[model samples]
Target chain A: MPAPAPIDPRGPRFNQAVLSVALLTGFLVDWRPVVPLFALVLLAGAALGPKYGPFLVFYAKVIRPRLAPPAEMEDPRPPRFAAAVGVVFLTAGALAFAAGHAGLGWALALMVAALAGLSAATGICVGCEIYLVLARRRPVAG
Target chain B: MFMARGVIVIVILFAIALAGRLYRAWRARLQDEKPIHPLVPDSLRAGADRTWVVFTSPYCATCGPVEASLRASDPGARVVKVDATREPHLAESFSIRSAPTVLLADVEGNVTARLVGAQAVDDYVRRPPSGVAG
Candidate 1:
């Protein structure tokens, strides 16, 4: 029989990029109260990171026993996903900061990074599911 | 190690960093807003009109060319994109296992074309054949 898919341990700390980009975006768009927000992002990514594995331990905890796992239980996502997240971080952060919003862009980027890390740690890809639900409704969500 | 200790060299490096940052600040521009994610989904075909969906991820570099040409050629065509990594459900509905997958269909709700990987839109537009749904 084919072996069950292994939950790959590591992926790019795309969240770090998200935090940085978020800060950059805020800077480019609006530069008020920048240091604190940007600093928060940097700290979060550095602290709770894309370590050798997730902080939550999906395989041992979420998956093995069976706890309402979603359809994508078989494959946790490719390592390439980290790169894509980075692109989103870089672009969105740059745009938001450049748009003259508050340093909210920095906060937003860090938030995404934290959520992303949380999801990965928990074996739940928030972005993937967000796409799924949105796609279900909108034509372009796909 | 002694070669790196020169103060003038460090000064020049910092100046270049500052210059690069300023350049980007001045030149930053946005592309025409285009969805760059899950390109296709089963539900995207739900509408009465025939549809063509492209499943793409930012990692797949070539999807941009295809999306641009398609929009320029026929603005009315339904070309949806869902970031695959971010939207695994959309990808799942269409059985998307890879990046840059393309799906096409007619008004009847049957898929006509399902192409995986980056495809040159010119080749599709020029020859413009019925896809998997027809």
Candidate 2:
């Protein structure tokens, strides 16, 4: 049989995000050792976006099909869209850090931070068009 | 013995769901395998702890509240999110095909529970101890 098509890597972004959210939650709950670890991963995902982005794409499109045979018309737009959203988070994080809004920055970072976790719990991505409707648009007027 | 067992069918079904979650918890338990340059790790376990392994995707909407409920209750079980996008292998390893998947594990590499669909936190509330292997 012909090889099955690739699963969308963007799909797992939600899961990965959810995982991180949970880990951060633990940090929040415990507030001692894990915050740094969470920060490291958060920072890394940002710095290494290009590297990991493609990997996530491949995983979502090609790899996911093996175990979870995707729907015929699975949304192919999430990874592309999530890249845009990642920028939003990184920008917010940067601004917060720059303006000395550590608390605000953390909160903002946490908002975008929920991406992968949201993905993991479901196939619906925060970056997809549907999310564009559910989530409020940014007020920056960009 | 048979009569006693037959009397608790609801409890038994609940037990089955909990049993299936064991592997999910294990897969979630799998730490994000190491990455040399701190980019996204190839394995789903990258940069994650054992407590959280959620098999969800970018499109799934139902998982949100379920996750919130779980975190609200335990406050420490940290839910590791795995985008079927990033680590499909990890999801396969745990035998999860559905979105909004959840795996409840401990820090010691043991998966005690898993839920495949959107489940309420009450689904996992105040139940008997889970039955995952060491």
Candidate 3:
């Protein structure tokens, strides 16, 4: 199998910033649709690659051109895997909201928001780090 | 009232995040060189001119890259990675609380330099060790 293409390191951070803001807004306004919608976007990104990610596409088109190219690029797989994990949290949170568990829904949603904010601000993607560690644990194919 | 609850969640999470950041910072702060523990196995340093003992954890993003860099920087040095999560006693012997905590030791097994993060590891690697000419 071919290796996945590398990506600009900033692309994931840009997506994280947008995701954090959207999640906070959704929580504050008690919007039921936002979490699931964002979850779908993340799912698409994880399954179909960066071209399918709305914010990543936006970054590539609008933001990336304005800035100087990054000094280093990074493996796209880890961040994409992180997006897949985010989908699980978001889906659970949305389910909680639908089932009238407001507190639980907010708790899960807020955790994702906080993590996304941390990644956006500091480039510390805990979910991505988890992905790398798990990858290391996997047995190599002969 | 619902908006207030949302705000409360945000505030609580914010406080927790701040506490975590401060704790990691405290843990990663610089310290004076210390002696290697006798209990640490002799085999870890047996064959290297300079042995780099790295304490790592499963979830540390920087650990892999730091190990790679350390290996590439010196042909003579050997890196010994200890999984801190699995070997808590070894981690405790050195007071390690952060991942990628690196100890640079000489042939005599005395730790000459201790580094806590990737940036410090890079800086240390860039310079020749204390006795070697740059």
Query: Which numbered prediction scores highest in DockQ against the true structure?
Result: 3
User: Among these predicted structures, which one has the highest TM-score?
Assistant: 3
lDDT of each: 0.48, 0.49, 0.77
- Candidate 3 accuracy as lDDT: 0.77
Tell me how far the alpha carbon of residue A95 in candidate 3 is from the true structure, in angstroms, after superposition. 3.0
Q: Which residue ranges in model 3 land beyond 4 Å of their true spot? A: A1-11, A47-51, A60-82, A97-107, A118-142, B1-17, B20-40, B54-73, B79-92, B95-99
* Winning candidate number (lDDT): 3
lDDT of 3 by residue, B65-117 (tens): 78998888876787899877677777788878667899877777777778877
lDDT of 1 by residue, A45-131 (tens): 334432323322333454446644332222233332443444455456556767865355555554554444444334345555554
lDDT of 1 by residue, B45-65 (tens): 666365767777644445655
Model 1 CAPRI quality = incorrect
Q: Write the per-residue lDDT of candidate 3 for residues A1-142, one digit (tens) a residue.
A: 4345557889989998898888888777778688888989888888898999999999999999999977555667779888888899999989998999988887788788888878887677889878766755661111
Interface RMSD for each candidate model?
16.3, 14.6, 6.0
Report how far off residue B117 is in candidate 3 (Å): 3.6
Stretch of 10 with least lDDT, candidate 1 chain B = B27-36
Tell me how large the interface RMSD of candidate 1 is: 16.3
